[model samples]
Target: MKTYTDTGKKDTRSGFGAGLTALGQTNPDVVALCADLTGSLKMDEFKANHPERFFQVGIAEANMMGLAAGMTIGGKIPFTGTFANFSTGRVYDQIRQSIAYSHKNVKICASHAGLTLGEDGATHQILEDIGLMKMLPGMTVINTCDFNQTKAATMAIAQHHGPVYLRFGRPKVPNFTPEDQNFEIGKAVQLQEGSDVTIVATGHLVWEALEAAKALNEESISAEVINIHTIKPLDTDAIVKSVKKTGCIVTAEEHNFLGGLGESVARELALHHPTPQEFVATNDTFGESGTPAQLMDKYGLNAAAIAAKAKKVMGRK
Candidate 1:
């Protein structure tokens, strides 16, 4: 097995903060709205720099979405910030009706998504937001992998003239990828190329997928890892090509198995190629209060689980 370089650790939310600040300077029309989660969502930099352009709505996520949608009417690109649960499930109607339905240029920036939110428990940790947002019309759903990619996505989404759901996490994990990498929405990054199996993952699970790739390599099983950041407008071509080469698939995510990244990939693969596939994700249940590692192990979102699932998917029975 070959050794990969280890980058320093950093939280993905910081990337969003950094990108928002850079966007505030680059685009004067960019406005920010927060539901009293500035620190959690890491929007303080943008709020402090562009105070006049930021609206602190005081824990009212629904109201913040409405205001963000309204701001889009006057040539303002509003970014509504909050946690994943509140960003989507709590304000689905507002986002669906006012933002997606009305065609508002609002960036729904959600932090602390999935089990990595750690110690928040099930009430706040939402694994279904991707499915919820992706179902909406004209909504672009993105779950960035690391700090740099999230920053790049946040900056790029500001230039896109429509509604977008940008999801990131709170845990300080591996910070791979280039510092100034250009983030192209709807495009997936091919991490490791292989022919045995393809592992598609998003958010915190991308690092796990990388770890699984190393493990698979040690076991003499070549596996391709694809960072599927954009769940809504999935990279169908990349998935098709990878599956065609690999002949099997395993999906990993820090989200629920029912309506998250894995399901999206499964739905696409089912149509294009009926390949053997397995999913390493949380089943139909709520999250629990524990350390990130504990929850990940319990919910089967770690590297070993992904590797095991990959072996199973390839019919290594």
Candidate 2:
């Protein structure tokens, strides 16, 4: 297994902010719009440096989406920043009608996503944003795992011409991925190679999946690990190739099992591979107020949970 060292802990949203700041210096066409949560989304640097290009929509998420779409028409690559719930669920109609439907070059940059949004509770934690955005025709959904990858994805989406939903979180987690790495859309990063079972994970659960792989290794279980950052344009070839080698699969994510990465992997396996699969995700239920660690433990979204699920699926194989 390839080893990954934790350089430091940083929130993925900071990565998005840094990426946007870099784009502000280089990309003249890249403009930003925020729904009155610039600090929470970590977009202060970009806004301060390029006030002319930054639009503060004042808590109007739907209006922000419409504004971003309109800016795209004027040949500007607009990035709209807000919480996950407001980014998709609250303003989905505007996105669908104005952005996705028209294939506008708008980047819906969502922060504070999933259970890790912490004490904000179910009302704020938007686990289904991935599903909501992915279902939109012509929408590119990306859920990055760490700071480096999030930054890379943010920059990469600016180059791609289409509507994109980029999801990140507020909690500071392990920044393990390389600082200088190429970000490829619809490409899976293979973390480790094994023969017993395959563990495919995305977003915050990806680091947990890697930790689980290490634990499984101690028990003599050869577990392959793959980091699936892009959920919508899923890297099916990498998933299928790994599953074909292992014959069983374990999918981990921070979202509900109903419409998240687990379901996408399940559908792919059912169609092409028919491998035994186990899902390490939130059951179909809303989250409650708590610290990020507490919520992760209670909802079975941690390393131990992933390892347990891996062992259970390996038994079926």
Score each candidate by Cα lDDT: 0.89, 0.93
Checking candidate 1 for backbone clashes, the offending pairs are none
Per-model tally of clashing residue pairs: 0, 0
Estimated TM-score per prediction? 0.97, 0.99
Q: Which stretch of 10 consecutive residues in model 1 shows the poorest summed lDDT?
A: 1-10
Regions more than 4 Å wrong, model 1? 1-3
lDDT of 2: 0.93
Best by TM-score: 2
lDDT of 1 at 109: 94
Question: What lDDT tens digits, residue by residue, belong to model 2 across residues 1-317?
Answer: 67889999999999999999999999999999999999988889999999999999998998899889999888999999999999999998999999999999999999999999999999999888888998999999999999999999999999999999999999999999989999999999999999999999999998999999999999999999999999988889999999899989999999999899999998988898899999998899999999999999999999999999999998898
